[model samples]
Target: MLKLESLVFDNGFARLPEAYYSRVCPTPVPDPYLVCYSPQAAVLIDLDPAEMARPELVETLAGNRLLPGMDALAALYAGHQFGHYVPQLGDGRAILLGEVKNAAGEGWEVQLKGAGRTPYSRGGDGRAVLRSSIREFLCSEAMHALGIPTTRALAIVGSDHPVYREDVETAALVTRLAPSFVRFGSFEVFYYRNQIEPIRQLADYVIARYYPELAARAEPYAELLREVARRTAELMAQWQAVGFSHGVMNTDNMSILGLTLDYGPFGFLDAFDPGFVCNHSDSGGRYAFDQQPDVAAWNVTKLAQALVPLLSVETASAAIGDYPQQFGRAYIERMAAKFGLPPGGETVPLLMDTLQLLAQNRVDYTIFLRRLCDFDSTPGALNAPLRDLFPDRPAFDAWAARYAAALRQQDSADATRREAMRALNPKYILRNHLAEAAIRRAADHRDYSEIHRLHALLSRPYDEQPECEAYAAEPPDWAKRIEVSCSS
Candidate 1:
């Protein structure tokens, strides 16, 4: 079991030169308490799940106490936000508590969000409010449950201390776990500064730690670029297939390892609008639902530019060249599995038509997809309830006929297909309203049961969870009024 008192941290990132980060101790919050935590995440570092309830875990997470071997500091990096390049933007409010190995001997970095002021704070109050913290904490775990790669939330510590956002709200800190928090922005900051050595050093460090297999390659740096592009394409495809809009696809938010790194202003597709902008602050809809793949390619290109000093321009360009095909292939394969159809030309059009059908009808993406698992190849009265979901019966009939034909061609059995599709198309997603509901009870009444309830429900997203079916229902009218931004 991982012990809070004696857990040894061997921080690889900290071993890099002082130029990569700012050594800063986390500023403590007042009267902190555990909001909720993930037992699954606690197990990632091989800690006993019961340990999450202990006071020391909450204290350490709340920045109230520093544990042994914890080399606390904030990362320094810059990125392009909404397509505009910012020369220097770093961890303004987060402090890395250093890294430790799990039972499998994998190093995981522990980080605290809303841990207070750093050199990168830039005159703003470096504290995260409970509102956004709940969203991040829940969604991080929720994404992982859906079989998507994302950073894990270990715990959330709520504080009575007030923090200002749109309103005066209480402070909260999230303990996020990841293999590495290194982003495309990490290399960008050095490149923009016209410093070659730091860029090379950062690249070398990343290669050694995460991409060690590339060490002996003739052009390891170029290979790193290709691998990043490939992984990023796959990540974007996963996001798209699941109807997830990251809201902000900033280079800094884009993980170098292709994990869903940051969780700000994110939303899942409620009504299948391709132009859905989850981040209200994004005036131009730059990171829209349908545009995620294209934006990801754009971000990968930025990472390629950052690596120009380490490899030839020709090699770097070639590395990112396959992004479109990579994303297309991965997306179709995932969508095919969600439809329980093997990916091929025949299934490709069915998937495209499904998207068109969903977009045209403005259907509840999750519900419609989940219900499709029980699709009958021989449609009859059995499909009436499914048919009721579409506004236009004719449109639904046309698509249903094609889908049925595809299933018949594959000789897919209803029982087997239903099981496969149900596993891929989750019954539960972190809908904005559901997250809002959890945040409300936790913030307004100081009752965190909803937070605990949500973490449990989302952890088994693919399961039926018949008792919690209300969570998988269509969003309410009040959900439309909810607007999240770059704030928090």
Candidate 2:
């Protein structure tokens, strides 16, 4: 058995007043067993990777056993869900098991999603299905491997216990790790209730913990708000450059620390459709791929409103106003990097022109980017691989001519340029079809080998895993039928 003393726990969020959250223990599931484990994430919490295979670890992760210093709780907050304010929404199915300081003394909160009900249950069963649990567990790691900011997953515990979603599904639990789970909604709750004291307390706590450098600023609170806005802008830019559709960008789901938080109905672009909406529940396409940058700005404006008590209206507005410029600069820099062009180069026009061409042809986004990495600047060399991706041969050739001209402006060797481009463009992404296939195998046959295989493949998404070439291909016709909603 792993000793409780082996872990170091610190309950920082619990230091706030009881109004911030409710103390609760997870409702244990029966017959807990390990479904998947992340060795990489284990090191972040100072846990030995080998310990993940221990039988007792499953019980501890399933919430049947509490390690020493574990002060479990469910946080409270409110959010605007789909543009409507739900005045009170909290962690209905997730429980914070407490914080563990790693070898570097950095603290990470270890929480279990699908660990039963809390005061914020809102009359629904506080259980997570195996399908969704597997999705979160794998996608978290995949996002991290792609060099994107995101919360990490430690392990998943599965059980025979039943959960009712679209159908009766087996229950499961995922252990999630992040510096803090606080969201924009955390402040909105107190702001809406006119609870000024707790609002100030939360701000001070967050600044002291996450934004310590801002503590000495003339307007610490205002600077904190600006920093959050800046980080959120950069995060959204990365999402857009990589063709990731968050599906839902609710204020509550927006991480204050700028990490990718919730993983519901999220999908990477298979075809380059800027207007794609991954979440079926988004009837109006409010959170469509193209609208994400604007929606993210709107969400930051809401957070600014909550901080009005501490920051002047002018100060808040100015900080929020900085989002568009921040997002634009970040997006341009990332896209430039993708093409191996220096920032502010004339190559930007070619990049934009290529996007329009991609949309016209409905090209596979990932495959196109990966193929471009092998682009030959040499004359008379075949550009067939990239040209074949588009149906309009002449249109693609015109764009290639401009791209080759841009490449000539660079003074680097072909091999060096290809290597740099390959590093930025991922060879693997957690596609919707890949996730659905894994979920089906686990749900129908109780087989979990696909889950493990994907975890391994996604851990090194940038590498060319020749053995897993099939995973890098476009989805088949049947995969287009799979629709993921908010329920996913």
Mark the 10 consecutive residues where model 1 has the least summed lDDT: 378-387
Error of 2 at 290 (Å): 0.9
lDDT, candidates in the order shown: 0.90, 0.91
> Please, what are the lDDT tens digits per residue for candidate 2 over residues 1-488?
22445887879999999999999999989999998899899989878888887777889899898987999999999998988888999999999989988778789999999999999999978888898899899999999998899999999999999888888889999999999999999999999998888889999999999999999999999999999999999999899988899988999999989999989899999999989999989999999999999999999998999999887899999877889999999998999888878778686677788899999999999999999999887755669999999999989888887787778778657789889999999989999999988999998898999999999999998899899999999989998898889878
TM of each candidate vs. truth = 0.98, 0.98
lDDT score for candidate 2 against the true structure: 0.91
* Predicted candidate 1 versus true structure: per-residue lDDT over 1-488, tens digit per residue: 76666577777888999999999999988789988888899888888878877887888889989887888989999999989999888999999998989879899999999999999999978899999999999999999998899999999898989887778999999999999999999999988999999999989998999999999999999999999999999999999988899998999999989999889999999998989999999899899888999999999999999999998899999999999999999998998889888888688877887888888998989999898988888854348767888898899988888889888888989998899888899999999999999888988798889888999999999999999989999999999999999994
The per-prediction tally of clashing pairs is 0, 0
Instruction: Record all residue pairs in model 1 with backbone atoms less than 3 Å apart, i.e. clashing.
Output: none
The alpha-carbon deviation from the true structure for residue 82 of candidate 2, after best TM-score superposition, in angstroms, is 1.1
Model 1 TM-score, 2 decimals: 0.98
